[model samples]
Target chain A: MNSVLTIDSAIVDAIVAHARRDHPDEACGVVAGAIGSDLPTRHIAMDNAARSMTFYEFDSMEHLRVWREMDDSDEEPVVIYHSHTATEAYPSRTDVSFAGEPGAHYLLVSTREPDSEEIRSFRIVDGVVTEEKVNIVDATVDA
Target chain B: MAIEVRVPTILRSYTGGSKIVEGAGDTLSGLLDDLDAKHSGLKGRLITPEGGLHRFVNIYVNDEDVRFLGALDAKLNDGDSITILPAVAGGALGFAAAAAFFGR
Candidate 1:
């Protein structure tokens, strides 16, 4: 049981914003950052993986964008993130089955509670998903 | 130092689909309790009655693994974050290893 972890404000904000924007269904995206201490979590895009049912799709184009951003910044892809509109904040069989040996952290956002933010983060090696406690540090991002 | 907790897609079912959650504590175990209180179903699913993590789950205080750092008792702080990940197995990509290391 590890103690605490850190995630980027932009990523967190992006996830929250998307979930709020598309309620009643799940929204998904990718995060790219250098791995080491605190791998920054940033959202690159959103999708209707299962517009009919409740599913998500991580856009490959956005992934390229984030990958390029990391490249320009001299950072490597470190994490991938997604949201569950009406599901638990934990990983599912689908997620595990599709999870490529990404060699980075896999972050998930929860939106079932609605009353309070059930946002949580975790790491998945192979198919096993491990939950990580996130400690948020507000950064200055000029809009 | 504050530990940043990373949220995954599955557990988002409990968070209303929020991607991040923050907490404070002095150990991985304590931090989980705090997190479970703040969010929901975090502790029950992650921790087992054996007083250790669910085995399928892995927690890290910073980059150091909780099992290596202090296990459930790993220390934490106001800014520290915890990541909850589960084992995803049953695939051709070393499914056994994934299940052995993670879960099926």
Candidate 2:
């Protein structure tokens, strides 16, 4: 697997918007893509069941439905994202412990600053966190 | 007594890369035991050492969370479909303390 996340700029904007919109409360969501494609094509904003500024958990039922839909579509969550309202864009101890999807890109968006945002991505597997490069490409450009 | 169990990507290693597997039991706990017999270590990932459901793992029976249905004692029908998913949870806060506070 490549150690970089090449996603559409539009998706990145949407994610940032979601994070900012839900500021003061952690926002979480998933970007799914065709299985083994390593390309994120769909953005799904999910509810933070915890709804706490310090924590985020996807609503269990919503998680089930989205996961089932992905299964039916032969897709996987390429990017699992959550915002940190007060901290930097890095995985915390809690995030690492719950990093179950080894193949996914764990994207962290820190909305700590009102006028700016910090975005980073990582791969957490077996309790190890490896930061990866994020390559935002224009959607209108063909690869 | 055939129940179809849908395995998540992370847990598919135990299922030999098969997304769906079959098991038999009258209760959710019994079904997990049955699966462990075949998959070996599968139950360990879903159930904690204390035999309770792992907080990070979520098991649903026919779209209903087993946690609300007596957890391990939840009844299972022959045609019931079981879906195992790792809960997507975390935060910037100290999770050890957060977990204790939330009783998760």
User: What lDDT score belongs to each candidate, Candidate 1 first?
Assistant: 0.58, 0.92
Q: How close is candidate 2 to the true structure, as a TM-score?
A: 0.96
Q: What is the lDDT of residue B74 in candidate 1?
A: 71
| Cα lDDT tens digits for candidate 1, B33-77 | 777887878687677776667654555555455666667767677
Error of 2 at B43 (Å): 1.0
Docking class of 2: high
Q: Model 2 clash pairs?
A: none
Question: Residues B7-101, candidate 2, lDDT per residue (tens digit)?
Answer: 98889989899989999999999999999999999999998898788888889999998988999999999899999999899999887776774
- How many steric clashes between backbone atoms does each model show? 80, 0
TM-score of chain A of each: 0.76, 0.97
- Each candidate structure's TM-score, on Cα atoms with residue i matched to residue i, is 0.49, 0.96
| Share of native C-alpha contacts between chains A and B (below 8 angstroms) recovered by candidate 1 | 0.01
